[model samples]
Target: MDNFYLLLYLSVAMFIGSFVAGLVPLAFNMSEGRTRLLSTFGAGLLVGTALSVIVPEGVEALYIVHTEKYLPGAVQNKDRNQIISNSLIQPVASNLAAKINYPTYFGNSVVGKGVVEQMQQSPVMDKKETDEYRHSEASVNFNAINQSIGYSLVFGFLFMFLIDQISKYLSSKDGDRTHLKLTATVGLVVHAAADGVAFGSASATNRAGVQFIVFLAIMLHKAPAAFGLVSFLLVEGIERFRIRRHLIIFSVAAPVAAMVTYYLIVVVENDKSSTDSATGTLMLFSAGTFLYVATVHILPELLGSNVKDYQLVNSATEGSSRGYSESRASLKLIELISVIVGAISPIF
Candidate 1:
């Protein structure tokens, strides 16, 4: 396909995918118990995605840091008069090396042994591609990806947390701590948010297929998340109109973020070396955002003591182990399992 047609189609597809995944669920009518189950599953997905995708990759990106600093110097030899030299650097898992520190099997891996040492020479095709310009380009793209994720996480979690605090404040002053309801209003379209970063990076990496995958994943999950929000709103005693409004706002935030990220990708690609500043800053922010989501948005609901007591009453105290209070606990269990399933499944 021609470039303009391809670009137009991709943009349209992305928008449609976001809407389908993120907006449709808000219109559904579902039980709080079911919503809880799905939400827990979603949480698990988030945790799993973060730890499995972002964290390990982030740590792996540390390999680039070593390469940029140490390997650049190490690649130098007295042989050729050329100022530039090339070497393949692989990411060695320090975490694994800590375990296999025996001298016999893993020769003095006190520091760390290379797990993916592509010690084999470079491919013929790579001989030309490994020149300064491509190196510089890849380096820049890597920095941008690092920064985009960092900033997204930071802003995302913090954005959610700030609203959570607002909800808490309102609940406290009204003598309704139990009613501190945050019904997926802050940044409910999580798939869109995730897709935004993925899309941007995919564009930079020229991985259009990867972007399509993200589009599909986001479409699959958004509806459930929106439904969860609606149920949460019911629990919080919100009016129907307000619930709809919340859903609309949450649904759209993701697309806007995605578009913004796309522009960022374009800009960052222009000059690769300038990525460190943005990437470093954004990464710190993402840490804060994830922490807030765990502590404020997800954890509080899961950790309620009354939920456990009610479930105990339902199951142990009587023949039936369900009650009004037990409802939350029951939902919490489903949520937990779903989360584990979504998060851990990806690892396998």
Candidate 2:
């Protein structure tokens, strides 16, 4: 069931990750003023999902492991200091840490108790020791790990920025106003690849539950995206036959990513070296991708004025709505519903 849910969720995400704004017949055929609003709404949905789902998880993981490395701390409560008597310094350090940054984490809540224990063990437990004594205490640093995360943040921003520009160029090709369509296809491919890395990394981390959640969220959004894209493709001169083919392809993206992720998930799940802390790194990478897509690519497209489209098309058709014709509204509604279904379907 977990695998099934995982597959379903991944597929849904890949579907939404490649949305088609041109599809919703209402916006496509409506007065251009309306389309701009709806597009922004779509962008909002993506942005909301990223913040609501991905970022918190990332931050939670980041805080935990980063604190362990950055803050002088020990597991609050229970005997975190091993019984080894080698100079007693290590245990003393652990005990000191328990009293300071995370008194609760290391189990030493009594202030003087912790200080005296540390001093007696310190061979130099002096009378001068105060509550402020631990303030001077230092622990092993993880400067290198912090530095590596800094590098990742830079790389993620650059990678997504480059991709966004390329997508913009591809979306603007004259012969293919289908530029959005084409670029979207590429975006979907990239989205799938990112998901593969995410779930794969999760499997390695042994927290497959989180990976499943992401998959579910992705799938929940894609159905609408596919139908919406198809609507856009029609404006790009796509024939019905071609549109159907594209929908089929979009629908399958998650399933494929899931398969790729599965092998990796299994391998990492069994590896002893891999830890939950690694999920923090993966989450940051995904969050970076999400931020890039939501801000650089999706939001601009949504917010940029496309109202001129309605003015131009309305003029060309002499008041006839390009897509929202009486004959077409039903069809478009179906597409919109399809999108909604794709968006929310994964929860079931």
Candidate 3:
């Protein structure tokens, strides 16, 4: 089907996943153990998606873009000619050439005849053109492009890290944890938007596999992330209606961002090289962002390092001491398993 339609479908799926995740805790109060398990599973999925799927694909896509953009047309033409001459079946080679649409080999060897005629007509003009082409070609360096992508990956990671840090700082300052909760929600909203961009960019590639994996990765985290956000607000004594509004906004953010980015890249730019480069950078950036969230933000909370500071733990402790500790240990084991399963799920 159409790539745009696929993107829209994925965006709607993301919204539903996030909305359900947030709604569950509000509808029925979830135990802390269950919440931790879900968060851990989501974290595992993000990590798995990043390392196993996103980073590798980003590198491969960028490499292909670099090769296509920088490689001289003459070299491609020469390669095509060599393949045609060496082929045992002339018709098969001819058919392959036609399918590939090799400009040099198409329509009575355009490259050869055209070059010969041009050279015969004006040697000085041809010489000047060749010199100019070589000079311009020298500027399209792969090293620079690779470096830019690397920097973008780092920037992506750092951007999320900054957001997390700011949220933490705001929470620490606010006695009621209201500011902290809101900050965290806002940060996540921004992340969801970034996830949308990643989705849109991947869809633009027109590769079903890439689109599927990316969609799965985003969906896996969206619900759990929303659940965490709404759960935090609920714990902070925020009204249910207000929480729902926040969830609605959060759910819509990513799809809207994805649609906008997709439209810009696919419709506005309309350049294949630009699309590939932008897509690759966005993927790498997303990988970095996912890495930070999974490892730094989610894992520590699941492991109970911040349990004492959590409202759920404090409230649960006020009721029963023995049950909380036992549940925590059991839940930790469950979290480990969930994380393992999440990380490996994409492989199959």
Candidate 4:
């Protein structure tokens, strides 16, 4: 299937999933406990996706880029003089060249008849020259690329952290905090856009297994995120119509971003190395964001004041000790199982 068609399918699925997830809370009037549970499950899935899928894929992509960019050149130069000598001595050198799988430099075959003729006229490279070439190859640093990716991951995490902090600060200020809600909404919209970028970059890989894993991971969290956003707005006492409008806008952001990013990757970037770099960086960045969302944001909310209050009251009121213990243990067990299920679900 065409990559664009697959992207379109994912975008449509994301839109529908988010819209439905958001509507479900309003339609069913789901309890706070259930909402928290769902959020926890989603958080677990995000964590699992980050560790099990995105990070590994990002590292693999970068290594592939490294090999493509550097290894071919190294291999081509390894026995250049030897190949050149053989071509000069042998009449049927081109046939020998066809048998030997030598690397091509700048798309020029090293042992072609034309190349051999050129080599016959030129002086053979000296030991000093060969040593110089090897030295130059050794001096070429790929560690910087690895460091850049690492920094990009950290930047992604910090970027989201800053947005969250800024929104909180704005909301805490005097007067009406509706603007702050908008701020938070914008932040979430940007995050959704990042998710789109990830999807685009992953699609660029053209690997069915990778595409499926990424698509599933994004879908797993997309709806729950939308549901949580709507629930937040509801708690903020925003009007129904306004919330609906916001939800519509939110649902569109990811798909639109995905389409735009995918176009840029396929058309503008148009090179394997660049595509790999972009895709790997995006994946790592997305992983960092997912880690923050899962651990710092969602988990805390899942185990928030309600749980603490229940524990405190149960401890103070000892008359129903057995029942309280049983209920608490059951809830904890359920939460643990839900998280475990979420974490491993991506393997299928």
Candidate 5:
């Protein structure tokens, strides 16, 4: 409940910050290079959050879910054969096999490669192979869970990829690009809602810092998107009133989505273990989207600009070439360092 309140406060701050960013275009000029630099930093932050915080924590949460399910009152049940069989026993069998050269422990066995090969040639090899086929139930369960996580990650990535393709197709059409701008604005709003979902999922965890880190990354990216959206609209000769209307809608979208998502997760998950499992799945899914946005969308934009700068340097007269190249190198260095700093910030 307290986490929800914190989310509320963050949402309000997000709205205000986005609104202010939207208004920036009306007040002053913003340079292209500066915007890209800021975006580069935000992209790096996303990369770090997805890999360092979200993925690891998510895997941990899922492992806990399995532990709670399979090993309830593990200490009390340690001596019970049925209970021990349901728990993690593959590692134990393997260890015993390594130490004792044992072939079977109640149909659970681990054998050396040479032994397996020799058994393969014997008349009873078929029986041994059948026995080997059966593995610890807990191992199978963990394997299935890991596979589900991988699928979720891929699904999230592909979902974002489709969105990006649709957005690109819309913006690529020739002339009367008002619709292009509108499409882009919708995409940003959708991205914001996804950010809200990430925050909501993280908040379901016991770690407050995880939720806060996700929120920080969302804000870092959201501010630039808001500002860039308005700036683009103004350049397209959009009316101030219409632009404000769009900005308001964009600002409100995230907080609303966040509140609704958090409420739904809390209400639907009746138990701690279930809630943690759901949170883990969502976090991994969010990490995939974050990877898409950071690596596929934002970071690659630098390539085009870097090429343009290279051409400009090549075309410059000999007299100014050295100075221009030095300036460009310095700028590149700064952007690289900014990204590094942003990537490391969320970890601490």
Candidate 6:
């Protein structure tokens, strides 16, 4: 199937999945234990996808771009010869003949031909010339492109951090949690757009299974995120209509961004190398954001103290210490296993 059509299908799936996930909070009262498990699992999926899929895929795409760009071929060999004849050998020989008053001797019609011929025939002259030239050219590009990738990753991470901090600040200042919820929702919407960019880039690559895997990883986390967002808004006493509006906005963000980004990338006619480079940069940036969301936003909630669990433990009978400790240990074990499984799932 065409990548455009494939992306369309995945975008629609994401839209519906997210919308339904948001509605889940309104439909059911989710248990604290179940919510934690889902969140932990989603965090693990983000970690697995970023480290195992997006980061490595981005690096490989760039590597392929440069490798193809610099590969020595018949055309490159011909160009190399012309460059050596016109630039390197001719300049030196012409100067030498002119200084010695032998213009005719080293002119284009005379010793210049002999000089070029001799250099071309020498075994050592062009033996590894193509390899060296390719290396030099590739090195400059690789360094610059690598820097771009690094900067993009850092930018993504910092962007999310700033969003998180702003939400926290607003939440601290306001007595009502509504503003904080809205701010956080905005952050998630932006992140959803970033995920769309990743999806679009993967589609641009036209690689089998690449876009599918990215879509799967995205949906896995996005569902839980959408659910959590609606739940938070509800807990903050936001009106049902307002919650629906937020859900709709969040649900549409990724699909619209995915279609727009994919169209922009696919419609513009550019060289394959440039497309690959762009795709790689976007993928790495998405990976960085994924890392931030997984580590800073999601995983910490699981690893840190739980107010619900603390309350439960406090309310337990004094004689239930052994059973309480054993149950706590079991819950910890379950959390660990869930995370490990989630982290490893993307590899398959």
Residue by residue across 1-348, what tens digits does model 3's lDDT show? 388888888888888888998899888876765666667787888888888888878887787876665443223224533433433344454455446543545456867555444433431223465466446663555667778778867987897777656655655665766555566667778778878877877777788787888788787777767776787788778999999998998899989988998898778887888878777888788788788767665664455434444432221111112233333433356668999998987677
Model 5: CA > 4 A from native: 72-135, 306-331
Tens-place lDDT per residue, model 1, 57-156, is 4434444443454333222333222223223221133333345545656676643334312222222224454465447755675686666656666685
Listed in order, each prediction's TM-score against the native is 0.51, 0.53, 0.73, 0.75, 0.74, 0.76
Look at candidate 2 and tell me the lDDT of residue 239.
79
Better of 4 and 5 by lDDT: 5
Query: Lowest-lDDT window of 10 residues in candidate 5?
Result: 312-321
Write the residue-wise lDDT of candidate 4 on 93-191 in tens digits: 445555654444324554454665554454444567657745665346466667867887798788667766665565556456666567656766776
Per-residue accuracy of model 2 over 3-43 as CA lDDT, tens digit each: 54555555555555543322344234444434433433444
Residue 347, model 3: lDDT of 73
Report the C-alpha displacement of residue 40, candidate 4, in angstroms.
Answer: 2.2
What's the C-alpha lDDT at position 257 in model 4?
Answer: 83
TM for candidate 3 is 0.73
TM-score of 5: 0.74
Question: What C-alpha lDDT, on a 0 to 100 scale, does residue 161 get in candidate 2?
Answer: 63
lDDT (tens digit, per residue) of candidate 5 on 164-239:
6666666666554677767767777777787777877887785789978988898888888788778767877889
**What lDDT would each prediction earn against the true structure?**
0.46, 0.47, 0.69, 0.67, 0.71, 0.71
Order candidates by TM-score, high to low: 6, 4, 5, 3, 2, 1
- Candidate 6: what lDDT? 0.71
Worst 10 residues of 2 by lDDT: 312-321
- In model 6, the worst 10-residue window by lDDT is 311-320
**Candidate 3 or 5, higher TM-score?**
5
Compute the lDDT for candidate 5: 0.71
Q: Worst ten-residue run, lDDT, model 1?
A: 310-319
| Stretches > 4 Å off in candidate 2 | 1-42, 48-53, 59-141, 169-184, 195-224, 272-277, 306-348
lDDT against true structure, model 4 = 0.67
By lDDT rank, best first, the candidates go 5, 6, 3, 4, 2, 1
